[model samples]
Target: MIESWRWYGPFDKITLPEIAQTGATGIVTALHEIPYGEVWPSALVASRNGEIRAAGFDWVVVESLPIHERIKRGEGDLSELFANYRQSMANLAANGVKTICYNFMPLLDWTRTDLTAPVARGGSCLRFEAAKMAAFEIHMLGRAEAEADYTPEALQMAAIWFQKASETDRDALLHAIMSGLPGAFDRYDIAGLRQALKGYEGIGRADLRANYQRFLDEVVPAAEDLGMALCVHPDDPPRDILGLPRIVSSGADITWVLNAVDSPANGLTFCTGSLGANPTNDLPALARQFADRVHFAHLRNVRKDPDGSFEEAAHLEGDTDMAAVIAALLDEQKRTGRIIPFRPDHGHELLWDAEKGTHPGYPLIGRLRGLAELRGVIAGLRHRD
Candidate 1:
C-alpha cells in the first residue's frame, strides 16, 4: 500500500512540506479552486503537479474532481457538463494523476452534527448523532416529509431533543450539517437548502441510481481511454438523510454500481469509516470481496452507538478490525501487483491542532499518530507473512 495524505491545495494551513515530513510519498488532492462543471485546463493540472513534486511528493490521486450538481440530478445541459468532466479526466491523466475519487451524494457531501465532539484523552473527534440530525431536519429545516423517514421512537426522541435545544444549539446543528456543502457556510441559507431539496422532489432511489448510472456510462469509457480509474466514494453515514436517497451505502449498493458499468475503469473508493458506520457491513470481508475493484482507500474507523449515532474513533480502536482489513488489502496488492494508495482519514484534533485552525477532522499530529500506528501494523503483518 502507498501511504498518502490529502492536502486541500494552497490555502490548506498544513503546507505540502509539512505533509512530506509525515513520511508519505503520495499526495491525494484536487483542484478545489476550479468551480464545479468547469474544465480543468492541462496547464493548471501540470502546475499543481509541479508544486507537489517540488515539495518532494507525487500527486498520485485526486481526492475529488467534484461532479456538478446538475450532473448528479440529470438536469439541463448535461452534455456540456459531461464534456467538462471528461476533459478534466484527460487533463489529470495528462499530468500523470490517474486515480480520481468522487461522490454522487445529493445536495451535500459528508455531514456531521458535531465537529468538536469531545473524546477521551483530552481530544475532540467528529460525531453524527441521529437525534441531533433528526432534530435539525424536523424542527429546524422543517422538511415536511422528514418525519416519515424516522421510526416513531426516533421521532419522539428528536421531538424531545428539539424542544429542549436552545437557540445556540440549533444554530450549531444547522452549521454542522450545512458545513458539508462546499463553501455552503457563506453561500447557502435555509431558503437555498429548501430550494435544493425541491429539485429532487420527484426523484427517489431508483431515479438517483439511474442518474448515477448515466453518469458512469458517459464517463467510465473516457476514464478507461485516459488510463485513469474513477472511484466513487460511499455515502458518509451509509444511509439516507434529508429525504434524499443514498445509492452507494451498502454491499448491495456497491454491487449494483459496479455491475451498472461493468468496467475496470469504474471502481470503488473503499472508505472504512463510511461503510463501517453500518453495523452489518463486515469491513474485512467486504475488503476481500471488493479488493479487485477498490482503486483507493480511506483508512479510518468509527464507533457506533446503540442509538444509531457514531463518532470517529482512533484509526485502530473502533469496531473495524484494522489489521484484518489491511491484511486483505495487502494480499490484493500482492496478487494484482498494484500498490493501493491509502491515507489516514478524519483524525482527531489533538495537541496544537485545535489552535492551528486546521480543517475539521484533519489535524496534523493526530493523523501523524494514526499513520505511525498504521505503518507499524503493516510492518508487523509483513513480518508474520
Candidate 2:
C-alpha cells in the first residue's frame, strides 16, 4: 500500500510540508476551485501534479471529478458535460495521472449529522446520528414528507431532541449539512438546495442507475483509451437519506455497477468508511472480490447501528475488521503486484489539533497513529509470508 492523505488543495489548513511530516508519500486531491463539469485543462492538471511533486509527494489519485447534476439528471447540457468529463480524463492522462475517484450520490456528496461528536480520545470525531438527521429533516429543514420517512416513535423522539435545540443548535445543524461541510455533497441554502432537487425531481433510483450505466458506457471507453482508471466512490451513509436514492451501497450494488460497463477501466474506490457505515457490508470479503478494480482506498472504521447512527471509531477498533481488511488488501496487492493508494480517511480531532482551526478529524497525530497501526498490520501480514 502507498500511504497517502486527502488534501483540499492550497487553502487546506494542513500543508504538504505538514503531510510530509506524517510520513505520507502521496496526496489524494482534486481541483476544487474548478466548478463541476468544467474541463480540467492539461495545464491545470500538470500544474497541480507539479505542486504536489515539488512538495515531495506523488500525485497518486484524484479524489473526485464530481459527476455534475446535469449528468445525473440527463438533462440540459448533460451530453456536453459528459464530453467535458471525458475530456478531463484525457487531460489527466496526458499528464500521466491515473486513478480518478468519483461518486454518484444525489444532491449531496457525503453526509454526517455531527462533525464534533465526543470520543474517548479526549477530542471529537465526525458522527452520523440518525436521530439528529431526523431532527434536521423534520424540525429544521422542515422537509414536507420528512415526517413520513421515519417511524412514529422516531419522530416522537426527534421532537423531544428538537425541543432542546436553541438557535445556535439550529445554526450548527444547518452548517453541518451545508456551508461546504465535509459530508454534504455540496452546500447550498434551503432555497437553492430545493432548486437543485427540483432539477432531479422526476429522476429516481432507476433513472440514476440508468444514467450511471450510460455514463460508464460513454466515459469508461475514454478512460481506457487514455490509460486512466475510473474509480467510483461508494455512497457515504450508504443508504437512503433525506429520501434520496442510493445506488452504490452494497456488494450487489458494486457487482451490478461493474457489470454495467464490464471494463477494466471502470473501477471502485474501496472506501471502507462509507461501506462500513452499514454494519452489513463485509469489507475484507469485498476486498478480495473486487481486488483488481479497486484503484484507491479510504480505510477507516465506523461504530454504527441499524438505525443509521454511527460515530468514527479508532482506526483499528470499529465495526470494520481493519486487520482483515488490511490483510485482504495486502494479499491482493501481492497477487496483482499493484501498489494500492490508501489513506486513513477521517482522523478524530484531538490533542494539538482541537485548539487549532483545521478540518474536523484531520489532526496529524491521530492520523499518524492510524497510518502506523495500518502499516504494522501490513508488516505483520507480510511477515507471515
Candidate 3:
C-alpha cells in the first residue's frame, strides 16, 4: 500500500510542507475550488499536479471529482454534466493521476451528529448518534415522513432527545448535519434542506442504484480508456439517513456496483471507517473479497453501538481488525503486484489539533499519529513474512 494524505487544496490549514514531513509520498486531493459539474481543464489539472510535485510529493489519487446531483437523481438532460465529468477524468488522467475516489450519497456527503464528541482519552472524535440524528430529522428538519423511517423505540428516543435538547444543542446538531453538504455554511438552512430532501421524494433504493449504474455506464468506459480507475466510496455510516437511499453501503451493494460495469476502471474505494460503522460488514472478509477491485483505501476504524451510534476510534483500536484488513490488502498487492494507495482517515483531534481549528477529522497531528500507527502495523505484518 502506498501511503497518502488528503489535502483540501491551497486553502487547507495544513500546508504541503507540513504534509511532506509526515513521511507520506502520495497525496490524495481534488480541485475543490472548482464547482461540481464543471469541466476541469487539462491546464488546471496539470497545475495542481505541478504544485504537489513542487512540494516533493506525488498526487497519487483524486479523492473526488464530485458527481452532480442532477446526475445522481437521474433528472433531466444531464448530457452536459456527463460530458464535464468525462472531461475531468480525461484531464486528471492527462496529468498522470489515474485513481479517482467518489461517492453517490444523496444530499449529504457524510452525516454526523457531533463533530467534537469528547473521548475518554481527552481528545475529540467525530460521532453519529442515532437518536440525535432522528431528533434532527423529526423535530428539527421536520420532515413529514421522517417518523416512518425510525422504529417505535427509536421514535420515542428521538422525541425524548428533542424535548431535552436546548436551543444551542439543537443548533449544533443542525450545523453538524447540514455542514456535511458542500458549501453548506453559505447556503444551507431548514428551508434549503427541506427543498433538497424534496428532490428525492419519489426516488428510492432501486432508483438511486439505477442512477449510479447510469453514471457508471457513461463514465467508466472513458475512465478505462484514459487508463484510470473510478472508485466509488462506500456511503458514510453505511446506512439510510434523512429518508434517503444509500446503495453503496454493504458487500452486496459493492458487488452489484462492481458488476454493473465490469471493468478494472469501475472499482471500489474500500473505506473502513464508513463500512465498519455497520457491525455486519466484516471488514477483513470484505477486504479480502474485494481486494482485486479496490483502487484506494480509507484506513480508519469506528466504535459502533447497538442503537446505531458510532464514533471514529483510533485507527487500530475500534471494532475493525486493522491488522487483518491490512494483511488482506497486502496479500492482494503481492498477488497482483499492484499498489493500493491508502490514507489514515478521520483521525481524532489531539495535542494541538483542537487549537489549530483545522477541518473536522483532518487535524495535522491526529492524522500524523494515525499514519504512524498504521505504518507500524504494516511494518510489523511484513516483518512476520
Candidate 4:
C-alpha cells in the first residue's frame, strides 16, 4: 500500500509537516474552499499541490470532487454542472493528482445519529443508533416514509425513543444527521432538507445509478484524457437511511460503476469500514474481486449493533476482518506491482489528542496506532510472500 493521510486543508490544525511525521508520503486532500459544481481553477489546484510538496508530501489523491444536487436530480443546469466537474478533474490532473474519490448519496454525504458515542475504549466516537435516527426522522425532522424503512421492532423502539428525547437532544440529533453535505449542511432546515430528499422523491436506487452513469459518461472521458482515475467512495453507514436510496454501498455498486465506464480511469475507493457497516458486505471477498479498479482505500472498521446500530471501532479491531482486508490489499499490490494509495480513516478521538480539535478522526495518536497496525499487516504479508 502507498500509505497516505487525508488532509482537510490549510485551516486544518493537523499540518502537512505533522502528517509527514506519520510516515505517509501521499496526501489525500480536496479543494474544499471552492464551491461545489464550479470548476476548480488550475491556480488554486497548483497552490495546494505546491504546499503539499513544500511540506514533504505528494498531492497524490483527492478525497472528493462533490457532485452537485442539481446533477443528481438531473435538474437545473446539470449539463453545465457536469461540464464543470469534468474541468475540475482536468485542473486536479494539471496539478499531478491522479485519483479522485467521490460519492453519490443525496443531500447528506454520510449520516450518523451520534457524533460522540462513548466507545468501549473510552473516548467519544461517531456512531449511528437506529433509535436516535428514527427519532430524528419521525419526531424532529418529520421525514415522510420514516417508519416504513424500519422493521416493526425498530419502529416500536423508535416510537418510545422519540417520546423521551429532550428538545435539545432532538435538535442536536437533527444537526448531526444533516451535519455534512455539499455546502457542508448549510441548508438543513426540515422543509429544505425534505425538499432535497424529495428531489429524489420518485427516484430509486436504479434511477440514481442510471443518473450516475450518465454523469460519468459525460466526465469519465475527461478523466481518461487527463490520465486520472475516478475512485467512487462507498456510502458511509452503508444503509438506506430516511428512505433515501444509496447506490454506492455494495460490491454490486462497484461492479455497476465499472460497467458504466470500462477503463482503468474508472475505479473504486475500497473503504472497508463504510461497506463493513452492512453485515452482508464480505470485505475480503469484495476486495479480491474489485482489486484492479481499487486505486484508493480507506482502512477503518465499525462494530455493528442490532437495529441499525453501530459505533466506530479501532482500525484493526472492528467487526471487519481487517486482517483479511489488509491481506487482500497487499495481495493486490503484489499482483499489480504498484502500491495503492491508502489512508487509515476515521479514528477515535483519544487522550492527549482531544485538546487539538482536529477534523473528526484526523488526530495524530489515534491514526498513528491505526497506521502502525496496518503497516504491521503489510510487512507480514510481504515477508510471507
- TM-scores of all predicted structures: 0.97, 0.96, 0.97, 0.96
Candidate 2 ranges beyond 4 A from true positions: 179-186
**Which digits, one per residue and each the tens of the lDDT, describe model 2 over residues 1-385?**
9999988886577788988998889998888877787899899899999999999999899878888877777776577888999998888888878889998888787787788888874878888777778888878766768777777767777888899999888778777766323322467766676667777766778998988888898899888788888889999888876778899999999999999988888999998899998777889899889988888888888898766688888889899889888887888888889899999978887788776677665777778888888888888988999
Error of 2 at 113 (Å): 1.0
Model 4, C-alpha of 278: deviation from truth (Å): 1.1
Give residue 272's error in model 3 in angstroms: 0.5
Residue-wise C-alpha lDDT for candidate 4, range 81-143, written one tens digit per residue: 878898888888877887899888776777787776777757778788887777678876687
Compose the digit string of candidate 3's lDDT tens values, residues 255-367. Answer: 99999999999999999999999888999999999999999999999999888889999998999999999999999999999999999999999988998877778889889
State the weakest 10-residue window (summed lDDT) of model 1. 180-189
Deviation from native of the Cα of residue 97 in model 3, angstroms: 0.8
| Candidate 1 lDDT tens digits, 250-339 | 899999999999998999999999999998899999999999999999999999997678999999999999999999999998898999
Q: Comparing 3 and 4 by lDDT, which wins?
A: 3
List per-candidate RMSD values in Å: 1.4, 1.8, 1.3, 1.6
Model 4 RMSD, rounded to 1 decimal: 1.6
